[model samples]
Target: MSLRWRITLAIALVSTLVALALSLTVHFAYAYRQAEQARQLQTQRLELALEEYDRTGQPGLRSQLNDPKLPDRLREAASEGGTAAMVTQTPQGAVVWAALSTTGGDTLSLRSSYQPQLDDRASLDRVLLMGAAALIATGTGAGVVIGARLSRRLRHAAAAAARVADGDYSTRVSAAVGGRSRDEAAELAQAVDAMSSALQNRLQAERQVTADIAHELRTPLTGLTTAAELLPEGRSTELVRGRIAVLRDLVEDVLEVARLDTATELPELSDIAVGDFVTRRVATYSSEPEVRVATETVVATDPRRLERVLANLVSNAYNHGRPPVVVEVDGPRVRVRDHGPGFPDEVLAEGPGRFRKGSGGGHGLGLTIAVGQARVLGARLSFTNADADGGAVAVLELPVSEGEDAPGR
Candidate 1:
């Protein structure tokens, strides 16, 4: 069940228990008071009957002399020379009785039917029952309203948290209207906002450091590349040039990573056919992969960024996986699979992280860069191992164009 319904049910259960307890208390108290009043009236009638019998030697109306039906307890009290009264339940209904001993060694008794008071009690019970039901309904309704408001606030906070988790550090949750006063939902929103702000600041500082270091090295690295190129042609010089080229490439990758971290670059979107785009990009590779076009889907995306993402995937597969690599385009979805050892468990679980190289190892920035570019294009990139074939498969799903149906449609 949702939080809203759980809270509503909890409130309703408590209301029901309280209504039952209060109804029982009111019902019993009212019944007790009625019985007391009946007993008092019966006692007064018995006393008048005793007075009339002593003067005229005859019982009064509805009064009995030496009544055989009187209860033993009432008879014992009357024999002690004092008036006594009691209310008892009978087959017909409740009955109130009173008795008194006369000077002639006889007991005078009186009784009245308590059915009328019982009828009044039944009416009161009906009213109390209806009142209790109304109370429960009112309480349940209030719970629904309150639960809905709280659930909405929580949902907003959760959405903001989800955006932050998806790398949109700028996302923040708005606080409640009345600045946090014992409202846990408002406090939760404030906490999410604070966490987002902290992460954004930390990431910005790290990106700045990375950009600064890459920029500082680029000048000296360029000078070294020029000087090395001027050297005489030999095995040693070629080795020097090769190392310099590798270093330059590393520097450029670092800079690109820093730029992606900032999330400030916007995509240059254009309409492109999925099959043609994949085929052309795969052809540019020195070792081309087998390409299969399964759909003629068209999408709006940045060709440059899409190529970057695809290049990274293909390169990673080649470097870490075995041939024959296959790139399949199905609608807006592209899958690159290489028959080799699948991705490590950690990589599959956490996706790619910079500087975390795999067993076949380069600097491990290839997949990380791919993920960043995919994010920029508003696409989804996922990694998985093939079920039947033991190979790593990278799936990239691009966003469909506006006013266009998805692949199946």
Candidate 2:
């Protein structure tokens, strides 16, 4: 539940409990007080009656017992409508003989007048009433203070979250209950801030990479267009042709990276002979011969994405490897090894952290694009320097599917 609502609920519950306690105390206390008052008042009436009886010893005084309307008066007072009672004994010896009708049912009458004394007050209504009021008031006050503090904390956290949502990652809530601990709200606020900060950093890095790619593509494009002006005729023309091909490769890599980076498409999967797939990729990219052997290797994978991955890896190796790219297939596994100067230490350390090339030539997004395509096809990509003597090894493991790679599944 929201903190605001919880705090409000807590306040309401405390108030209800306090009110109930007070009501019970008031009811019990009023009853006790009414009972005490009736008894005291009855005692006073009894003393006067006894005195009257002592003064007029006619003995026929039983009929005119000092009070003709005493029973009705006592009954009226006792039936105060708040506390029920009987007119009970007044504790005077011989006072009963002086009495006439005991409408109080004779159970409350005394024999003769005795010395007046205070009754035991073991259960004082006043003390109980005061105690209940004090306890309830104190408890309610404490609850109010706690709820207020909790609400304040929630408000602070809510404001911080709103600021973060508005793209302000620097926003933070204070971890204080008048300067103490940062509760659950504060922790959540802090987490949101951290996540926004990290996302912002990543976006900035992507922007930089985008800018670099645009600049690199522009130069190659201009060169290819400028060289196209010279007609295809001799050795110089052949050089221009090679340059044109390189420019095309660069353009294709750039487009591939763009697609990989923002792919909103899933791969079409199929069960393909892994060895044959490897042979096709090797033949497509490698000028040097490639080898493929069939094994119990079958994988459900998108052929096009797999092809792209193999093409990129092989092209990368051909550009840098010494010669001879070897392709091998195992159970749901494929490996491409190059007899090149392996991979640069820099490339190995960074591991597909886009736009880092050691040869100082490639678009550098080739391996990154390949890796992304592999991921979309539910595949794995790995790279390692083959031997201590230097050469690059690439592993691509694709999951086998039951159908052919095609459009619309």
Question: Following a full C-alpha superposition, what root-mean-square deviation does model 1 have from the true structure?
Answer: 2.3
Q: Relative to the true structure, how large is the alpha-carbon lDDT of every model?
A: 0.88, 0.63
lDDT of 1: 0.88
Q: Output the lDDT of residue 80, model 2.
A: 44
lDDT of 1 by residue, 210-259 (tens): 99999999999999999998999999999999999988988999999999
TM-score of each: 0.92, 0.46
- The stretch of ten residues in a row with the least summed lDDT in candidate 2 is 93-102
How well does candidate 2 match the true structure in TM-score terms? 0.46
Candidate 2: deviation at residue 334, Å? 0.9
lDDT string, candidate 2, 1-409, tens digits: 6655566667667766776677677766765665566556545554555455556643231334334334454445433432122433453421222122233323122232222321223244446556766766676677667777778877776776677654455565443223456666566656766777787678657855764785678786777677676676888887777777777776666656655655455898777767776766666542845676746565677888888887878778777786777777775677878787887776677677666765637757778888888878878888899766568988887765555332222
All predictions: root-mean-square deviation over Cα? 2.3, 14.6
Instruction: Specify the highest-lDDT model's number.
Output: 1
